[model samples]
Target: MRHLFTIALVSLLLAPPAQAQNDVRFQVLGGDEALRDALIAASRLQAVTDEEDSASQDIVAAARSDYARLLAVLYEQGYFGPDISITLNGREVAGMSPFDRITQVRSAAITVEPGRAFRLGRAVIAPLAPGTDLPEGFRSGAPAGTVILRETTEAGIMGWRTQGHATADVGNQQITARHNEAELDAEITLAPGPVYRFGTLIPRGEERMRTRRVLRIAGLPTGEVYDPDEVDRAADRLRDTGVFTSVGFTEIPNPDGTLDVQAELVEAPLRRVGFGAEIQSQDGLTVSGYWLHRNLFGGAERLRFDAEISDIGAQNSGIDGFVSGLFSRPADLTPDTTLELGFRIEHLDEPTFVEDTASINIGLEHQFSDELTATAGVFARYSDVSDNFSERSVWMVGLPLGLTWDSRDNAFDAASGWYADATLTPFTAFEDGGGVRATADLRAYYGFGEEDSTRLAGRLQLGTVDGGDIAALPPDWLFYSGGSGTVRGQDHQSLGAMQNGVQTGGRSFAGASFEIRQDLFGNFGAVAFYDVGYVSEGAYGEGASDWHSGAGLGLRYDTPIGPIRLDIATPVSGDGTGEDVHLYLGIGQNF
Candidate 1:
């Protein structure tokens, strides 16, 4: 009884304090105008939306205090004055009025003073030693504009380092103003301090894999000058070995102005399996799979197997089956010679059309140097086709020879430079009807800017397939265009010489395209392109005189897999059929 009485007395004492806290509530008056003024002063608000049912009334009290603090801030910032008033039940709230009111406002603008343009007043080059050849274009008396400054200053210094002067530097000497408002004068100086030569060639981590063949392919010499391009090439050559996960080169500069380049390597998994699926606007759906073994026989040999199935988007859909085998050796079978064997089988069906082909090829590849590779292969093919227009089978054999010169520093992310490859197939076929099929393809790219993000890539392809009558030719041997790879405004395999909406076979076809890619907004990019192509019955004949040209704009999204491309093209010249637009969704650049 005594404890219970004590408890009752304590509860009685705390009851009043709790009740007073619960009754603590204020009504906020003035509508949107007051809220706006409060927001302008405080920039943020802390209001309780669920306070109506909250058991803890402390939150509501805190919210009211925050509101009152905002009002106080407004008064201190002079946003409120006598014109703005706060009253409760016809009584003004003390200390709730602004100190001052806003009046007139003003803005700031930029103004440029008239002056002469900047010009190159003089140029001088200081070589590390006498008799060092300074390349042309790095001279004084040249213009001092941004363009000239870049070519003579930045590019010049880089060029000197590429040649052997690894410690080269450039500085502006003097500045003078001319009378013209757009003209100024300046002097440029260059210091090619010292020429650095390559040190010992050391292969780290994967010495056994970096055989003589790989070193030869890298094209890096111990006595040669230290060049960034050469280092990059060596890295690429090592990667091509297919034996390493990652390969890179680092240059360590010496106090004597010499640089020691180190080639670092990491071993990679020799065997891999990959699978992917794609959906296309034109091709509809495709599923692909591949299996690769880099060291098939443990001597840096490679073997790959690939399979793909596609459903073309059209009234007439087709299924294609392909099986291929490729075998190669790293070393020259006979000094300076390499050997390759290839075989393929294909089957296709579209509506009432069906075709089957089998081919076998053998080739010899010879590498004269790191930049040049030549291959000559002989192949025999048997093709059979059955369609509404014709049903025929033919066997043909030919020898194709090709040469490739790749000097580009990067294959996947090239910022500058170019590469070229040319192939020619010339021979007679012993089939139903025989003729020559020849093709040539060329591509180039050039990068601008310090980061090499701005680039221009161009391509040209010319081919001729002449044999038998048009009706007697195999369906697979015919040439077709009009797609993301050709003209974007046209349909896949639908562009060629046509007669009354029907394909009239042509003996030759030629195409050329150029694209300029500019990086914008981080990983996003924009592209402008032009394409032209024509098909002819004979070489340079009037029958093929009608050529079509197209121009378009594209947006690119750089993704981890590659570049996602979206293109919209319009036919610029041809039969006036209004305007045609095509949207392409694919990976990598169009080129």
Candidate 2:
């Protein structure tokens, strides 16, 4: 009887015989649909390429793997529980097989309910224990109920830790939902502790290169109160030296709560070489190359050599070719003096004349203080010209002496600052046709902004040349304008006095330009500007009437090299025959 019972049980267990046992299939449901949705979501997230069939196939494969994991979880959660009943489209499927059951078990639709986003309610900071050297007022004015509160708390705690308060921490802050979904109220509390003072500063590697000069530029001071902003500023100063490949600062907390600041600096390559080229629509194709030895002869001296060749195009006046040589020495050589010397050669091809010229200039610049610098220079040029109409060869010499004062915080970028510069040149005739000439130039810039990036900039320039009378002036003594740098919306060198198709006269020019710079997206910026100027022969008389004005819009790309500029300008007042719209592409701010 027992044997007979066992045989019957085994037959029943084999189960092709019972309907309930046949329903136990493990179906691979949710795999296909979940995989499809996941793939679509990933493609949207990463902007996957759909044009490639192979890429789509790969995504599908990946999605399949992901969905397999989800299906495994469902299986583990008893989707095939003891009371399992597999159905498709409301019809029962008869099976106990794993594959058929899984195929019939589809994923249930998911629904999400909207939840309120919490707003910041309050923030509280606590001071470190007594004998600590942390600065006070370190955690003040932090807005309550702000998403940034958490980040600010973390930053504050980190700041305290850097000041030798290793045990410093931020207390819990809470956010409460407001009646208005979008509005938030902020609460803040301060917990600045004792002032942390620096203990020591250590220097290493190439001591000659890490001398006082380097230390001064490094911007770290021993015995000063500890502040994160100070530490960051020091790091920035060191990096700005351009002599360090890596820089790091570490603070060690002592038993007595004092802080020891240690800085580690890695020397950059002492020597470097670079080459570059550019093609300008107006200046034509140009090639430039340069080599630099940052630490020439050691002791952090910089030596550089550069060369450039510009091919003048049809849009340019007379000048067809140019070459220049320059040398510079740092101000540390003479306490506050920086010296530079340069030589240039230019080829001029006018409609009626061809000329070759060479010039040499020497300049001495001295920084009276951090906010004031003075420059004085002397330049001499010799030119040989063949008159097109006169059919005569003419030789002339020119000498210019000038002084400049620059106090602007940023030479290339000034949003809320003021700078003024003036130059004077007195000329003497050295040849038969030579006559006395004098020229004066002045410029000023003013900025108005609470910060450096957002501000209004105003600029003014005035230039005048006099040689007793207009006709007595040398051709080279006259002022010329018309380009993005001068009066836009016109041709290059197409302004000033003209006589018989040549600028044989001298004139005075006065102009003012205003620009408002606003930050746009990321590193990009936008600028709107208006420039007004006039060129006249008479110094201040009614006859000095030729004046023109232009307005323009510009886009600035803050590139690593400089700010790349694209400007479109229209002549507000002009002859109207010139190009109505002028476009410019170049590096650096226009000022």
Best by lDDT: 1
Write candidate 2's Cα lDDT for 466-510 as tens digits. Answer: 443333333445555566667766655556655445544336667
RMSD of each candidate relative to the true structure: 15.1, 13.0
**Full-model lDDT for every candidate:** 0.60, 0.53
Instruction: Kindly list the per-residue Cα lDDT of model 1 for residues 1-591, writing each as its tens digit.
Output: 999989976765554221112222233233335544544344221233222433223332333344456545433322231132322223233342432111211111111111222333444544323434444534444333444444446665776777777767874455454544323344556777667877655566664464555555455666766776767666765676577888777777777655776667777787889876545455466677888887665556678777777655543357666878777765546434657887888887754457898989999998766778899989988878785556787677888889888776766645565667777776454545566667777788899985877898888877777555556566666555555666666555455554233454456777889889999987899999988777765543335435677788988988877677777777777642346665566666776
Off by over 4 Å in 1: 1-237, 246-265, 275-279, 315-317, 333-338, 349-353, 367-371, 387-389, 406-416, 444-456, 466-472, 498-504, 539-546, 549-551, 570-576
TM agreement with the true structure for every prediction: 0.58, 0.53
Instruction: Give candidate 1's TM-score.
Output: 0.58
Q: How accurate is candidate 1 locally (lDDT)?
A: 0.60
Q: Worst lDDT window (10 residues) for model 2?
A: 17-26
Deviation (Å) of 93 in candidate 1: 52
The candidate 1 region of ten consecutive residues with least summed lDDT is 104-113
